[model samples]
Target chain A: MEAFKETLLSSFIVFENQLNGQKKSELHKLRQKAFEAFEKYGFPTRKDEDWKYTNLKPIIKHDYKIFHPKEQKLQLDEARKYFLSETDTYRIVFVDGYYASWLSLTTHHQYDICTFSALINRYPEIADEYVGKLINHGDSFTALNTAFAREGAYIFVPDNKIVDKPIEILHFTTPHALPAFQQPRSLLVLGKNSRATVIERHISLSANPVFTNSATEVFLHTGAILDHYKIQTDHYEASLIDNTVYQLQGYSVLNLTTASLGGKFVRNNPIVKLIESMAEAHLWGLTKIDSSELADHHTSIEHIAPHCQSNELYKGIFGGRSTGIFNGKVYVAPHAQKTNAFQQNNNIVLSDKATVNTKPQLEIFANDVKCSHGCTVGQMDENAMFYLRQRGIAADKARALLLLAFAGEIVDKIQLPELRQYVKRIFNQKNHIDFDFDL
Target chain B: MLKIKNLHVSVDDTPILKGISLEIKKGEIHAIMGPNGSGKSTLSNVIAGKEDYQITQGTIEFEGKDLLELSAEERAHLGIFLSFQYPVEIPGVSVTNFIKTAINENRKAKGLEPMPAKELLKLIRERMELLNMDKSFLSRSLNEGFSGGEKKRNEIFQLSMLQPKLAILDETDSGLDIDALRIVAKGVNTLRTPENAFLIITHYQRLLEYIVPDFVHVLYNGKIVKTGSKDLALALEEKGYDWIKEEVAI
Candidate 1:
């Protein structure tokens, strides 16, 4: 851990030197402050309560290359497969932490969809308003990502406008031979009475390990609506740490869903703050992992205002000695009366060696709020299996069907039909089931 | 076409079926009436190849083959079907898809081609109409959120679709209302043929009134103590199983 810290410290100095004389800018000042914070509180270990189930030692031990000098390009045909092939979307793609303008279809008309660096150069005022407002400064991973954030996605929807097309933010790591480390930063803002949809993913093209630490901040103004989905189906050698925070105003709606299907090690931190009355947030996650993979989701929802509502449902299917963790915390302020919050975590452990650990923490200071949570971890239903088998489905096919049904509850909630089919295809591929039967 | 000789079964080392013997020919409908916990379910479950029960001494032959050697699904592939009393709810799998998978899997096991999509759709629509089920019901998850009557009706609907040679109704009349019971009985009566047999397991004689049976056997304490015609079912319904228990004690 110390060796990795020293390496990152030296890399930060070189990263700062390449900033090109923007030292006096507010954004750069924040970067410096974030760097100091990262330096002070290095990587978190298993000793930390939040990181109790996730060990970052194995992920950070590799001497990963932090900078890429040469510009990497992907063929249109090669990159087209990763895009939503069935629907038209505003794409902002990055290759090796560098924006691929030629591969992107961004716009600056009614909506602003571009890279973070482009946002800083063009709309610095907007960047200053929402860039680091909701980030947790005490966390080393978010601080490290902020210190080196430059070329990820920047999406802004102005007031009273509903964008017709969905926005896709894609990061593809094209590592040649050495291990690569990337820090991708994204910011999404929906103005008052506005609406938008965003899809974000991180992919590694090769078998080499690519470690990604990412941070994203979302702001939904009064009467605004935002639907966000994160797809974490990267290579098995890749490890990802994602920190996202959503801040909601009065009457705002935020629907955020994350599907973690692959990756060797994954840790997701999604925090929601209902800052005004009548705000609503729905957080959903589905994780399906096998082998020795580890997927940890630590979510927190803070009901700071009255009459706010939140619903969280996270489900996981573990196989082949995999490990899963779901730690959810809900905090209701004293003044937050009539706060309706419900949370549930359900997991299915497929193999005898697989494991699932789920914990739900609720702190309700207000007496009038309705808060409830439940967690369940068990194997597949034997009665359901027998039912299907008695109907003539083979044992293996029956098992696969049951597992798919267990996951269908979450997948069915995806608003986009094409995206739902894409997720189903990916799930079937991962589980080696031929889902040719007409849905 | 089915025979069970001197069958003795146990679950968790405790005897459930002490000794039972029964025989049925093709085109015959045999009704097994017994009180609760009299091993009625154990008989149906054992015949369906449920792994929870152990057969201490038995020989079950179907179409002159050793039925005990086959798995539940293998038995299904060999033309056996069990209509569950409490049909398991499988969320997310629509009724159409579940039936399609079941039919295709049975075909695959028997070295036959899958039914074409058009043919399957037509067949499903026809069967749905026969069962008095609406089109929307086909899209709902298999038995999920369905009413008690709908589950039993769906079980009968599956029987009509699979067209199995030996169909075991495991307390299929437990939760059905009169209308659902009539529809289910109608489905069974329509599917009966000279090449197939039916074993209806129930606690009441109401279902037999609709679909009259050729044989009514009183199963008491894991053994079939009395075998008679459909009149036996009405007699037991009038006197209750206490008369059967008293006769057995004698």
Candidate 2:
């Protein structure tokens, strides 16, 4: 713990050395304050209820060095497959903890679609106000990310402006100089009455023990609509801690989904705050684990406004000795009456050694509201398996088909056509099986 | 060409079938009628290689192959089909994809390549038409949200698609209305040929009117007590199994 703190405190020097005098002056105070919070909380242990299933000691114990966005040149041929090449969009690509200009396509259109490091330089006030506002800093990782929140994507949709094309933020970890500890923070502040879609992915080129602490803060103004997706396909040697927070104003709608197929240990914390009436939020996730992998999803929706609604669904499939966890909470403030909230977490343990822990919590002080939550854990239906086999489907293929179908409950909800297909396609490609059903 | 001699089956150490013998030849349709708990469905499951039923003393030969040695899927690959009394519902798996996978797997087991998509589509459309099913039903999830009649009809549709050598219809007439029963029987009749055979296990004789059988056997107390012509089904349907029980008592 002391080593991680000392290393974190020392990285400020390395981070500031790369910046100019003007840029360093703007962010110096905020970094120090954020670092103080990180030092206070240190690393959460198993005794902490939130981190019960996930252990961060293995990741934080490394004698890590601060990562700088280097000038490494990677061929487009190598990194193109990680992208959704069929779709055109404003793409901001980061490689080895550095922004790769040759591989990125940022926009200068009516609304900004660029990098976060650039936002801190170009517009420091907006960056400072919106950066740490919604980030719940009690968590040690969130504080750590805020202390070195120099790298990530910056997405802004101006009021009344509709960006027809989706924005793609692709972060590729190459393990360039050493085992990299990267904190990439993205801030998405959508203007009033605007709508857009954002797709984020973490692709690893080499498996050399990379740990990424990523935080994305989205501010949805009145009547804004955003369809957000995060696809994590890192190698087994890499670990990812993803924290995304969304604050919705009146009459706004936010839909977010996380699809995790790779990474040895993955933890996703998606928090949504509904602050005004008629606002709705849907938080969904799907995790499929095999071998000794582990994936934990923590989701919470805060209803601070009246007549708001929130729904959460998370599903997982575990095999081998893998483990999974889903903890969802829906909180309605006392004044937030008539808030309808629902949550569900379902899982299938295909092996005896696999385990899953699911908890759905709802705290409503309102008198005239409807809230419900359900959870179930079971194995593949033996009757269904036999029925498929009686029709001559091979056992292995039958299992794959049933699993893909089971996952379809969540995959089908993906709105983007290419993104939906890519999610299914990548899962099949990773399993080295063909689940080519016409779903 | 199938033979089940001295077949004794037990599930969870409790005997369900005791000393049952039957022979089915090519081009023959044999119907087995019995009362509740008469082990009619047990016979179909045993023949289909369901693992839960322990075959204590029996030998089932299908076209001179030791059928007991094969798995359920292998039994399917060896041209054995069982139209389940109750079809399983699978969500997100379309009927088209399910059947395509089943047919391709069967072909692969026989060392054949997957059927061409065009050919498979043509075959599916023809079978669906024969079953009097709408084309839209092909896109739906397999048996998910389907009514009992629709589920039974789908069983027949799959029977027509797979076209196995020996087909076993286990209680296929239980949940069907009169109209669905006639259509399903008609599909079965249409698919029947001199080279393939059928073992129809039913509780009522109403289905025998649409599907004329060469013989009807009365299974009582886990044994075939009576084997006679199709007239026996009509007589049993009229007189009920009580008369058979009384005669066996005598």
Candidate 3:
């Protein structure tokens, strides 16, 4: 315990040295509050109810070097290699947790666009207001990220402003010599009657083991609409811990879709807080696991106000000895009447040794609310397999075809033409499935 | 040619085919008629190399090759086909893909190249016409949500595609309607050749009127007690299975 304290204190000192004057001052104040809360509540262990399936000891034990803001040139051709669609959307690139202005497109006239580092330097007051407001500082990982939050992206859509093209922000991590840790944070504020779509991609160029602890806070005001997509396809040696909080106000709509394809260990926590009347949210997620990689998704949808609606569906496909964990909870607070919440988690294990642990829970304090949760875990149907094989398809090819059909349910729901095709391509390449879907 | 000599088989240690023997030469269509629980279906399953039955003492030769020593898939590759009584349903697998796979596997086993997609499609369409099946059946999942008649038609469609040497029909007429029975029998008759044979197992003489057989054998209590020409099936229809049972007892 003493050694852990020393490690935390030293990491904070290193974080302070990497920031400028105004950013350092803001972090100093937030650090003081976060430290107090951290002292009150230490790191969450397996004993904690929410952290039962995922243990963070492996993350804390390693001494991760803080990634400082440095000027580094990125290969533009390589950066644009994976974009599936050709559009006039603005592209922003960040390297090693710091925003790279040279690689980012100019948004001079676009009032809805701003970088996190530029906003922190220009309007410190706006950054100070909503930076750490949505996230719980007592959470050790969140606090650790707050202490070292160097650079990310910030987008604000004013009232009645609709952004036609998706804003793509690419967060790339490059480990030069030693193992590095980067925490890229983003704060999206969608004003009333405004609509926009943001796609956040995390990529790694280095094959060495690295850690990325990312936190994104989305604030949807009354009558606002936001569509968020997170694509995490890092190298197999990389680890990712991402936490996203959606705080919805009255009559706002927020839709979040996440795809986790490549990672050594990935833990995604998506929290939706319906704070006002008639606020709605939808969360859809798909993850494909192979080899010994592990992916865990923990989501919480809280209906704090009356007449709110939320739906969540998460599907996973596990092969080899890989393991997947999904825990979804819907909490309907008191006085939040007429809250309709539905949650479902389904997983298919291809190999005999693969395992999946899914738990869906519903807690309703309001009497008039309709809330339900369900989970299913099973292998492929044998009768179906025999039927296919008798028709003359080899066993292996038949299994692959069924797996693709299983994944089609979620892949078909993606509305973005470019991203949908990109997802299908990635799924096909990774699973070796011969899919002919033209999407 | 197919030959079976004194086949004694048991399922779960219970005797099912007790010293049953039969022979079928090329260009012959033989029907084995029997009542319920008379080991008619067991003979078909055993000939197809199903694992559950134990051939205590039997010798089955197909084209001068030992049949009992081959695996189910191997038997299929060696021109043995069994049209199941109850067809299994597989979702998300199209019928075109299933038939293509089956055809290619058998072709490879016979040291032949895979059929091209264009030619395969042409063959499938021709067979569909022969069986009077719907063209949409080729695109839908294999047997999923298919009606009884449609399932039987699909079985015959597969038979037409495979073109096996010895085809075994195990109660294919059980759930089919009269029209479906006529279409299926027509498909079977069209596929018959001088080098191909068939062993039809049924409980009734209704199907024999469509696809007339050369010989009909009466199976009683796990053994064939009488053998005669096609007229025997007609005589049995007039006189029920009890006549044969009493004659065997005497």
Candidate 4:
């Protein structure tokens, strides 16, 4: 812990010396505040309630250097297969925590789909209105990410303007002379009566230890709709900590699906706050972990307004000593009448060594609210396996199919057609399924 | 083409079938009728190689091959089909996908490539029509929320699709109404070829009125105690199994 703090603090000093000072004074101040917060908390241990099932001390012990590539030197061909290479969509790509403008296909045609670095440098006033506002302050990793936040996706959808194509944000990290550690921050603002689909993916191009502490703050204006899909299928050597906070206005809808298929150790914190009445949000997560990997999903949905509703479903499959943790909480405030919230987390442990901890927490103060939570940790249904085998599916194939079925429910919720097919292929390959049957 | 000799099967170390023997050749339809708890479903499950049933003492030969040595799916690959008494519900796997996987698996075991998509579609549509099933039924999760009649109809539909050499109907007519019973019976009748046989294990004689059985056997006390022509089912339906128990008492 001391090593990480000293490394980060020294890096910040060097980073301060490099900055010219006059124009970047506000960003420097933000970094100083964030660094102070990180120094107070350090890295969370197993004793913390939120980090009870996830221990990051091992990951923190590594000597990770902050990355700074020269220029936009890589080609789209290098990161072609990682993002939407086939389809035409707005794309923002980053390599080693630096935005690659030459490889990116970002546009300001109807709305702004650009880089956060350029946005923050060009128009810090508009960028500061939303950056680092929605996230909670105490989490050390999130604070650390804020301290070093640089380049990621910055999107803005104009009011009453519907973007026809979805946006793809691909963050590719590769170790150069030193093991790279990245802090990629993304901020998106959707105006009223606008609709857009966004896909954010973290991909590792090389087999090196890359730890990314990323944060994204999304703001949904009234009646805005966003279909967000976060694909965390990184290499086994890569670890990720993603904090995504969404704030919704009245009559807004946010449908989010996250597939965490690969990663050595992953911690995802997605918190949603329904700030106005009649807004709705749906959160879905599917994690398939194996080979001693750990995937933890800590989610919270706060219904602070009357007549708001939220639905959440998180499913996982663990094998070969892999572990999974799902701690989802739903909070309905005192005057949040008629709030309907449902949360479910189901897990299947395929091996004797695999472990899973699932907890669904609901705190409802409104007497007239309808809130329910369901959680289950178990093995695959024996009867279902027998039924599949009776139809001539081999034992291994049957097991794969049942696991696919458990994970496919979330995959089926993906809104993009092309992206859905691509995700299914990824899912099949990750789980060792040979067939290409549709979901 | 199925021969069982001196078969004694037990479930959970408790004997359910005691010294029962039966034989059925191709192109013949045989019916077995008995009261409840007479090991009717047990016999069919045992034939289908259900792991729960232990054949303590038996020899089951199908086409001169020992059937007991094969797994359930291996037995299925050997043209042995058992329409389960209770169809299992499999969520997230559609009925069409389930049947496609089953048929392709059977074909693969026979060293054949997967059937073409168009050909499989044509075959599925034809069999679906024969069973009077809607096209929408194919897209639903397999028996997830199906009614009793719908489940039975699906089983018969699968039977027509597989076209096994020996088909064992274990109480397929239990949950059907008159109309559904007629459709299921007609589906089974249409698939009856000269190279395949049917063993209809049922209680009521109403199903026999649709697809007339060539022979009928009385399953009493875990064994077939009486073998006769189709008239035996009618006699049992009239006499109500009590007389059979009394006559077998001695």
lDDT of 4 by residue, B83-135 (tens): 87788887788888888888888999999999898998999999988988899
Task: Enumerate residue pairs that collide in model 2.
Answer: A69-A98
For model 3, name the residue pairs that clash: A392-B101, A392-B102
DockQ of 3: 0.28
Question: Which residue runs does candidate 4 get wrong by more than 4 Å?
Answer: A22-24, A68-73, A175-178, A436-439, B247-249
Put the candidates in TM-score order, highest first: 1, 2, 4, 3
Report how far residue A234 has shifted in candidate 3, in Å: 3.3
Query: Arrange candidates by DockQ, highest first: which order?
Result: 1, 2, 4, 3
- For every prediction, compared with the true complex, DockQ reads 0.80, 0.79, 0.28, 0.58
C-alpha TM-scores of all predictions: 0.96, 0.96, 0.84, 0.94
Give the chain B TM-score for each candidate. Answer: 0.98, 0.99, 0.98, 0.98
Spell out the clash pairs found in candidate 4.
Answer: none
- Candidate 1 residue-wise lDDT, A1-439, digit = tens: 7887888899988988888866777889898999999999999988998988887888989888888765756876788889985248999999999999777899998989998998888888888888999998899999999898887899889999998899989998875688888999999889999999899999899688899999999999999999899999987899999999999999999998899999999999999999999999998899999998999999999999999999999999999989999999999999999999999999999999998999998999999988999999998898998899999998888888988898888888789887888888888777888877635
Candidate 2 vs candidate 4: the lDDT winner is 2
Tens-place lDDT digits, model 1, residues B1-250 = 7899999999999999988999989999999999999999999989888887889998999889899998889989889999998899988899999999999999999899999999999999988888899899889999999998899899988999999999999888888888888888888888889989999999999999998999999899989999999999999899999988888899
| lDDT tens digits by residue: candidate 2, A275-320 | 9999999888888888888899989899999999898888888888
* TM-scores of chain A across candidates: 0.98, 0.96, 0.93, 0.96
Q: What does candidate 4 score on TM?
A: 0.94
Model 4 docking category: medium
Native-contact fraction for each model? 0.86, 0.81, 0.25, 0.54
Q: Write the per-residue lDDT of candidate 3 for residues B82-111, one digit (tens) a residue.
A: 898888776555788768778887887778
TM-score of chain B of 2: 0.99
